[model samples]
Target: MTPIGTQELDRELKKGSAELLILSLIEHRARHGYEISKLIEERSGGVLKFNVASFYPLLYRLEERGMIAGRWVEKAGQRRRRYYKLTAAGKEMLKTQRSTWRDFVHAIQVITEAENA
Candidate 1:
């Protein structure tokens, strides 16, 4: 699809920033990759979508860095799914990242729409 409206551009921006968003989501709860993708989309009002290939490597890297923990869970006669949860270190990091993200967005909002200039 061709790039279009402001909402579309907003989606593009969120897609580019999805790794941080996913980490933020899982910092609260352990989520499988697909579930993370869904929550990003849902929470963002359908503005964020993550491709599996891009999303998992970042998840693995965060795990490797001890920023997050991953586990595989299996149920009786069910599929095993990888779930990601925040480590204490990850929660600290996420607190900082979230503050940064909020500040960045607020700065943009202020510049773009502040008092209608």
Candidate 2:
């Protein structure tokens, strides 16, 4: 079997996981784009990083789909930041996505274990 290059692997992982990452992060509380990106990087130990170009579009797409809601929040000293929170639909989506991801991982594990055996 041919081995996947690092770039291809990274791209595939990000494409599959980005929505789940964003939805899971905002599942608990609202977060701005930067915050969400930072959290994903931090939580993943810097394995995953999303630049503004890629990040904002995904956020907007989720918002457009009514999965998430974004509001501009202004603090006394800080500039206005658009924070995103999960909607009821997002919550349901999250549940389904989680199950799907788990099943995917399990299937991969089974295949790899068979290969090893």
Candidate 3:
């Protein structure tokens, strides 16, 4: 089998888990785009990062799909920001996605264990 490069692996991981990461973060509380990106980066110890160009479009798509809701808010002495929160549908989606991810991880673990045995 062919080997995968680091760049290719990073791209594949982002494509597969970007939505799950976003959804899981917003599940706890509403956060603006920058906050979401920062949290993902920080939480992953700087291994994962999302650029604005890619992030905003994905957020908008989630809003359109009714998975999440975004609202603009103004704070005293601060610029307005749009915050996103998970909706009921988003909660349901998160549950399903979490299960799917667990299953995928388990399968990978099993295969790797067998290979290493």
| Per-residue lDDT of candidate 2, residues 15-37 (tens digit) | 89999999999999999999999
What ranges in model 1 sit over 4 Å off?
Answer: 1-12, 115-117
Worst 10 residues of 3 by lDDT: 108-117
- lDDT string for model 1 (1-106, tens) is 6759997787577655765787788865788888888888788786566667877887888899998899999889978999999898888887887888889999
Better candidate by TM-score, 1 or 3 = 3
Total clashing pairs in model 1: 0
For each candidate in the order shown, give its overall lDDT on alpha carbons: 0.81, 0.95, 0.95
Off by over 4 Å in 3: 1-3
TM-score of 3: 0.93
Candidate 3 residue-wise lDDT, 10-88, digit = tens: 9898978999999999998999999999999999999999888998999999999999999999999989999999999
Which is superior by TM-score, 1 or 2?
Answer: 2
RMSD of each: 3.8, 1.7, 1.4
